[model samples]
Target: MAAGTPRVFISHLSGVAVFDPNGDQVGRVRDVVVMLRTGSRPPRVLGLVVEVVSRRRIFVPMTRVTSLESGQVITTGVVNLRRFEQRAAETLVLGELLDRRVRLIDIPGEEQGQAPGQGDGEEVTVLDVSMVQLPARRDWEIDKVFVRRGRQGRGGPLRRRGETLTVDWSAVMGFSVVEHEQGAESLLATFEQLRPADLANVLHHLSAKRRAEVAAALDDDRLADVLEELPEDDQVEIFGKLAEERAADVLEAMDPDDAADLLSELPESDKERLLALMQPHDAEPLRRLLSYEERTAGGLMTTDPIVLRPDATVADALARVRKEDLSPALAAQVYVCRPPEETPTGKYLGLVHFQRLLRDPPFTLVGSIVDTDLRPLPPDTPLPAVTSYLATYNMVAAPVVDESGALLGAVTVDDVLDHLLPDDWRESAHREPAQVPVPVPVPVPVPVRGEGANGH
Candidate 1:
């Protein structure tokens, strides 16, 4: 390690705020870019992949970084806005290396021989990497590895006997070599804190094969959440790879509207097969949704909106609104209905905005505070009308009812926007630039004053 250089664990830097030299917030760190070297040499740290406020990830070379302290990064303020694209030789530390199985050699200088203690040294799984900047240079390289000792089990490592330790980077092996069937347990652990949308973005940038591996590793609910945020093509591809029973379970875990949308993209035979695998009660709402036109309220609305009876108290409504899994739009208000709180609920009475609940006493009945004048949307309402209704009424979600006046679902603003945007909107929003500059191999030169990052 370089004298006076502070070693920082790569995992600790994930999602750390990046700022300009003048202290303006730039973005959050998404991943570290590193180039693996041949033989036993440590991989050189190339740059950071930062997701800015626009959600577009851009590359910021190590040279641009002025300080990494107090859990924040200070940069020289000259960041390129072009989207990041991975080079053939580069690897993402968080995406590719974490949780990977490797052997920790007993001797520091020995790179390839079996150790005198246990065969193949002691097997370990990588948990994180630590890097240090080279002395008098702007370059950085990984120097330490944090690893856990254990063979991987079906659920994960045998936690009771697993031991974790930090070792010199050169003491471990297998990072540079590609494993065709790498398990996603460790990688998923590194990303467990990410929101579904951010996790989906990370998955989007991985190789298709690795993406499938990660998707399969995620539990049903987590996979369902990520699938909803993923691009349609990616969604279809990953969903297609899961075993039929697991696929049906994941679909059932998803929001009814999202599950319906995914099913609509499949062949009739495949779609029906998965649907049949689901419980009859779970498949019923999806069947109803499929009967509606693609761009209509019935198709876009989620059947699981917060529904409450008129007799329910404001306290009851507030408790329902506090559910952690409810989206902001769906949690914005509570639909007041007669009997049967589930969708296809009896008589759509009215809605009580969350704001109204806040203003009333806990004992106040929702029936007394419900706003009936705003009117409910018919299931057949067109997409444009739904969008306009949300905007004009300043509503985050609007109730959708049938001719018989039963509440079927609620259309949230996000669902409306999803339909309004162009089919390729997601692709265009995060598209890579036409060209990318490949990093030069190590023995890196110090940056000259006023020199641009990655040669601009």
Candidate 2:
């Protein structure tokens, strides 16, 4: 680390507020741009990719950055409003570097051959990289590499590991012009371990082309999860890029309510085409959801909750919940129904909250202990009514029924919240002064200065 240089992990820069010299908020930092160099000579930071109030991405050259510190980045107020087009040689720290597996130049005997590797080096996953502004040149460069020594587990949570190595940038290898060309290749496996929301956050920071590339690399189920977390506009864009069959498969993997919401964002013709390509069983629920006004309970409920017979035992109910790869909210409760089968289920009986199932003996019949006190929501119930119903019942999920009392589906809390939020909530959430954005200007270089923020 250079003396008098302010050091920060690249992640700490993500979403931090960027202010002009006049103390006007320019935008929030979306990505850090760095040009790769030979021999791990701490790639020079090029500039920042900033999204302004209007959602336009502009570039603020490194030379314009007066300070780079904790919660804010102070720039010289000379932003180039001409949109940022990532050059072929530049690497986006958040978009392309984080989570990438790289080779650590192993010092022969010091490193046991435990880490996964190729012929020349030991493999380590880049958790983050620290960048610093050298006082003299006043330029930023990657100074330290934070890495987990192993080929990260793919497709699930990573196993806890040995101490993370905070190595000088030179001790790290693998970042190259070749990596920038290959795209998220070395990072996809690591991405598999991220929660859908986390992956969506990362995707939101990439260029459209790079975002599509990463989205294409994800498995249908993973892509579905990620898509559900994204804004509707983003959802539509990525879904449009998929082959119709693959898009249908991705929709099938999504919660029916989420899939319906996403499909509703499309032009009716495109929506219908995708629906036609889906398996009939998968498409039916979404079709029914689409038939309703988006603010209605019918439109917000997923048709895939674990459904059990009135005669089913706790053990049977437990088995169903375990068998399905349902989201937490969906798995929070089970519906007891009179049925020839689950979907288009016969009659809506009472419900059994998961906690109740856990409380009773395994052999106890779920129907015998059902909670019939909380009434099922009508398919036509409006969004406000649905929100109130959920809040009053203190329920994470509520069942929906048609006029005939046949079970339709169940609405989860998250779905209702999405509806209740402001139309631009997704965008606003990213830049709001009171939300994720730091309300205080941080000491980036000389001192902090901004509205709604205290200077250091």
Candidate 3:
């Protein structure tokens, strides 16, 4: 190992594609794990949280990693597919360390070689960390930390105070590899930095009590986003922990389809109770969706989409698509109806593809060029039928209509794929321990439940 052998910053590692010996993409790197060393040794790289094709995260021991370069990580072919569980002693850099405000510890009257904050205890934010393969060491260890003072948020344009001050890992505090304890507020702050999907994955790996605590710590909107990405059982479990009103608010914040799916898993008593707590307008669509069998098109459709009336202009339609945060499949086209442009919209007339919108003048009516040729499916249409309808027309989404010809909702390809996957897909484990190369247990990181820094 050499100092110039190309060190990779931990911040740049997130979402980086990781490949196996055969060059097959396994998954993206979600987080890096390391163990704190005693004496003056730097923390050693232990493993990586790699999310695979099924969206299940697993641990890839550093011993199995061959190379980290060119924006991609290469593995030595030995992968332990067992879903990763954060050991008591392991510290997660990205998930727990990034964006933490810490006080730098320094010796008094040692200004010449003192750390930036000195003994004055100024707060600094850990932006990113660096890992290097030190000479004569088999493992890469945590080295220099990239940080900014007077700013405690995720990375943005590089900023500095008086001058860039380099601090060794020993200069910072709050990381304890012995009793990894964290205040509730510290964990909450760290959780806020993770993506919703990543947070959901992390919650899944946590103890039930820990999950409830973390869930309770999130705001409703954020909780709703994370809940949507979680499995039904986990969703229900977390919901059970929330107050009735809070749970309803979270449900209302969720996409109607996902909310309905979660509700459908609940008993009728619990379902009605929660529905009653939600706003009538928001609950109505979910009620209708729940009535449809889980395998039906109606059940898979999302209530929200870029909708337009026949009289609306292409510009109006385009503007709607632009303003709304819709998935690509849902935004591919705008549905044209008679009057109402909301869920359970007016009698379905047709749709305007994005290309057609671009071709027509902004003021041109969407109805004039609408593709009525694309027939909409009924609420009771089977999942197989919905799949065929989308495939036949090469459309990413298809409208679901009722007997009265009113647009109920629109089903996207993503929802359809969810149904097509094996029912136990979420429950399946993609990782299994390897017999030929067993991972030896080592010392763990005593973190403060998450990333946090305060000069000791």
Candidate 4:
């Protein structure tokens, strides 16, 4: 058959002799197997089984089969039937390991529903019985074998489709008439589902190139999440493997605070190079963030705050709020500022609550409606004080100002939390207990008894 041509049912000519390339009779055809193709017109022959005199069965592909003549089969290569026999007897391969009925044991905490006798114990309580079978070549190795009802389309008389058990190659302990599928590919698939923190942990266990391969496979959003969780040093190191444009794309997709943090750790020259490669708009925010101290409110805050002109109507403010890509932390309140000044000094009058903005009349001026009682903090204000101020006012965020009272940025509650409770918060602090004053013990000068008293 042609390389890609589809084939139908293949006849298993039983008792037909199998011969080596030298024409010596070796074995007899035992079985012919067909692997069903989902979209193809006809199923194709996966391989052939030959039963040898040693009571061992070996699998040979139809591709290696040359011809079928009168009571004889011809093959291309002189495969040591012994080697094939040894391999078949030693390990569980696809054909023999499947279709045998086995019990399914659910791992604790992994069960979705409460089945009888299912708990956090290792007791091999039979949850369900299923027939184990080999998977197609394209299936993941860990999932090489599947479990299903032995009889197809039969009702109440036997097993139901719902009761069938599926076993992963990794879950099986031993193989008797069964074999486990490869686990490497399945592991990769499972790795893909892990959260960014878990994925970063796995990445720490892999080599740099493997890390790059796994990272390259992730979607932009997922990749950005993982990048944000990774150590700053690791971020720079892994980013080195990606193309400049690809790296720029990922950085652009990352949160402004996270992207700024990563860039801050890079050498100045590298930072400039990466920023230059990024989209102008994305790079602009990152540049602004980079200019601030890492622990400052401006550094921790997101630059995507919603701002409306003081002279604009509440309707216009509401419209702007609905249109901008504001973070949830900053979405509750919108700042009212003047148009971009020549020097861009913070000329904002106050902020308006989103609820108030929505409720006010359309013609109400934003400045007239804004809450002037808003609490503002300087960018240089300590994080503890910033957090305290927000807590005291019960504000989602407080506007950050420079020495000139020009609105530089707004610090959200989330940023304050991040600054106060870092990932390695404990590790960053001294481990020793704080010193406490101990009472000084008074020492009594013990007089030499005999010398102090007059000699007797």
Candidate 5:
């Protein structure tokens, strides 16, 4: 073990023969068990099992190793054959040694939300697996077959057992162990797997550019979910990287309230750009929501709700609901309102749960089916008070109305959570104060190295 010589582990010594100091061949070196010294412990080798007499087994202290050569090993002395006679069949077991070779896979450019199969339309490759062993954190079991020039070769393992190797598992395009000779470079080639929520958490930890790369790698639905979970600041930052049309598509896929909250944080110019790119129908609800104060009930409600005239048949209401693609938040309940009058004003009559509507006859008047005992909140009510009301009544959402009882919007449970606690609250709290630290003018030091014109 010279100071500059690289320390290496000898795996797969099965074909190497063993000899004693006298130059007589005793048997073969079946396996060499090395104890790994980790932390503050001194290094010690244990369980050195050797095959002898061509069919017998013997256990000897690693101190017996005289020298390891290219094709064989030399020992100080030979052991009694009878002592290993009973252990011949089990001498090759490397449970303690082999267990150290297990390694985890690491894939680059592939994040938690990206589809696992492909990356950016290109195939990914599974790189070499790393291995680690116990007690010796400094040493690794690297006896993997290294394929080079379309031929098989041997090399020391770079990773420890249970350690992960990031890889592109998309397709088996081609491979070369030389390509992964550098551990850091290899790890950088594979992507990491993470859940949607975890991905959002990671985005918050990354720079704006890195966040955008991850967002782009994800599918529309996954990116939308992550967008909903991200802080308003991060959402705006990441959204800036996407094309206006792509950004609008992601927003349209998001819950209207969540989309509104994100859009409200953008510059007015950027907001309008995104809105202009959105489908008119999808953009309409978000635009309307952006008009309201972020903390207000109207701002927190989804406008794409199911509404029916009190005089309309229950069947007709059901028909309208079935015909339209309503968001889950809006589809939870049906609001029964007065039929449109000449002035185009309608009154909020009552509410009907989707389940109840399905159980009643289609011809039944919506007013007859609407529960008169409606839990309604005024538009101007504070969000906290509205949350308390919902909890007290155990309601999924409460209808919001004007003084004249006109149906305005519905405040949902998700919106309530958003109103109560936004994602950036902590970051905002920990952020540096708005007032910049003023610079105190200091006396300037004159240069002494260079003298005046004559070089004095």
Candidate 6:
């Protein structure tokens, strides 16, 4: 530990209230984002996931944090309202680091965290971690780990048998990528709090064997969510490894458009086999989607969109719009239809933007406030037409209606962007896995839990 370097344990920041420079409350810290580096180098702290008043989690870069004392965080007052989206190289310290089992490199004549009977590579369960700003630099890095000795139990580390200790970050091993026989259980448990896209990013960088193990361990809904965010080749590879019945279940959990997109990549026999395993009702939408050209509105549109009958109240529409799983684009508006609310819904009456829903009384009928001025796109609309339609109207999502004026589905901006971007875009932007150096014993002072060098 450096003599004058300021440091604070991450556990202290969990759920701490954050305020602006003027002292007005902004949000609460949810997690610290960091990028785990190669070898013994400490992971660089990136930012904080702050949950704002509306419960929308946003990122506050560490550079923006002016103070971290008194059990509260103070930011620069300027905060971005955009939701935090974890990237490929980033890791959430609180979500994916704590409770992880790592090892202490055996240093002759020097020890602290190791149990009495344990030899070299003593196992420890991470409890907390501390970050320190580099001397004369604004960047912060994880420098110390607070861990408990012994195997973890269902409740937690066995209280009677485990001894907690803190050690320098370099004294431990297993934080970086390594080719070994590690199971995915601990990794999966630590990743439970990550969003699907974030989890997909983690999986994208993992070894194929490890990726397969983790995919097999994930539940149908979770695997489906992760699959939707993965690259086409990865999706096919993972899907091919699942049991037929499990594959069918995962397909059912995926959005119809995504399921169709994935299925289009598989051989006809394989696609037919999986579709045959699925429920007829679930397979129908995929079948409809598969019938269209890959770049057409029908192909790009999600079969499921927010749909409400004309007579439905604004309250009911708002309730549907508030679902957490719906993307911002899909949640931007609700479609008003006659009946058979699911797409292809009965005669499309019009559409109601979320803003108009908010402006109207709760008891007001959605039909009354619906916007009929904007014309809907046909399923056969080309990709260029869909792009122009959305861009010209400044819309995040556009409606797709059949010739009979039935609400078919909706094409969201994300889907449009996906089609417009290069096929390898997702894979091209990520950084390669960091190199891991062999662990060597090093003599270093170990700090006990709850005490940082800065004495915070």
Ranking by lDDT: 1, 6, 2, 3, 4, 5
State the lDDT of candidate 6 residue by residue for 123-212, as single tens digits: 777888999877766567899998777754332233345777788888788876442444455457655777887688667755576678
RMSD of each: 5.6, 9.8, 8.5, 26.7, 22.4, 10.7
1 or 4, which is superior by lDDT?
Answer: 1
lDDT of 5 by residue, 1-456 (tens): 112223333443443667777777766654444333333232233434554443334554444455555666676553433322212112122322221121122224433454544323222222342222323232223322111121111232232333333332122222221121112221112223444554565355434544665577667777898887766777778888888778989988887877888888888998898899999978887877787776777777766567777788878777766754455556667888776521112888888887887888888887887887866777677778888888897777888877887777788887787667655553442231132211212212322311100001
Score candidate 5 by TM-score against the native.
Answer: 0.49
lDDT of each: 0.83, 0.75, 0.74, 0.56, 0.55, 0.79
Best by TM-score: 1
Instruction: Point out where model 5 deviates above 4 Å.
Output: 1-195, 205-208, 308-332, 338-347, 354-367, 402-406, 422-456
Candidate 4 per-residue lDDT, tens place, 240-316, comes to 87888888889999988788888887789988999999989789888988887777777776666667777888777
Candidate 1 matches the true fold with a TM-score of 0.86
Q: What is the lDDT of residue 326 in candidate 2?
A: 71
lDDT of 6: 0.79
TM-score of each: 0.86, 0.65, 0.68, 0.49, 0.49, 0.62
Clashing pairs in 1: none
- Candidate 1 has an lDDT of 0.83
lDDT value, residue 247 of candidate 3: 90
| Candidate 1 ranges with C-alpha deviation above 4 Å | 107-122, 151-160, 432-456
Error of 5 at 203 (Å): 3.6
